[model samples]
Target: MRLCVEVFNGYRPPAHLRRLARPADAAEVVAQGLVGARRIAELRRPRRPGDRRPKHTTPVAVRRVYLCEPRSGAVEVAVALVTGERTWAMALRLELHQDTWCATTLRLI
Candidate 1:
């Protein structure tokens, strides 16, 4: 599948799992090494009435990791939002690993 479609579908292959050098790999290398503070805030915010806010609002970091197969033209990535705590936030990043690198599409689910 094309990188754009795979990312949307969130289908990741097994081999791509090993390439997860670190939680931040995709964020730094692929996602332009940048973190969207507003985006994080939106995700961390309480969506429902029963949802409780964190005791403290801490700044979390974003990282992206990927799995790719050249022959099959498939790529899968995981975007991790790391915080001081062990249980941070994370999103699935899927793409096509091509000769020309581009993060054309993303899904934060």
Candidate 2:
């Protein structure tokens, strides 16, 4: 989903998603960690010089997203990421808290 992409792209929650300018949910995921900033950097790294890889490597793309609502206030999301020729899978769990959705967990599948 766009929200997932936006969060991962910057490795931080968007302003609108923050509460009192504090994004505790996303901060938790980035801190105790899933898809840390280091990981994102690694994924976006360009092929090294003279590596014989294709010149036009594709940017990271969201290939697929599967959402599941197992309960009224919880959501589970499975996402597939495509970068160049490889694909990676990630999962995120969210819950509605105080009328706002908060990320409880995020990890690679």
Candidate 3:
């Protein structure tokens, strides 16, 4: 989830997080998310002279984690991502494949 926010904030490249997802989903997320994230970063309001916030800070964090094991080798994770501007709810499905967990689906709720 931190990886997703980092990608959204332009702090990390989409490819860095893409490895977590299946190939097709990775490609789709990159095509849809990367470009939009860049634009969103650009549109963010710049800091003003009177603002006291640090120049660099972690603006994203996980507010809560909801995990469910539906079956062996499969789990669903729901989390709330809190950012400076707003909170985003996300759901991810992960499956154990080749002894490694890989994201099968991701949804923004």
Top lDDT hit: 3
Top TM-score prediction, candidate number: 3
Measured with C-alpha atoms, the lDDT of residue 65 in candidate 3 is: 93
Can you write out model 2's per-residue Cα lDDT over 16-65, one digit (the tens) per residue? 33332126565656543334334655655656865564455455578988
Deviation from native of the Cα of residue 109 in model 1, angstroms: 2.7
lDDT of each: 0.41, 0.62, 0.72
Worst 10 residues of 2 by lDDT: 13-22
lDDT of 1 by residue, 25-109 (tens): 4444234222233345565678899999888765444544445544454454555545445333333433444453334334443
What is the lDDT for 54 in model 1?
80
Instruction: Report the number of clashing residue pairs per model.
Output: 6, 0, 0
- Model 3 misplacement above 4 A: 32-58
RMSD of model 3 against the true structure: 4.1
Pick out the ten consecutive residues of candidate 1 with the lowest summed lDDT. 1-10
TM-score ranking from best candidate downward: 3, 2, 1
Candidate 1 lDDT for residue 96: 41
Instruction: In candidate 2, list every pair of residues with a backbone clash.
Output: none
TM-score of each: 0.33, 0.63, 0.70
Instruction: Please give the ranking of all candidate structures by lDDT, highest first, separated by commas.
Output: 3, 2, 1
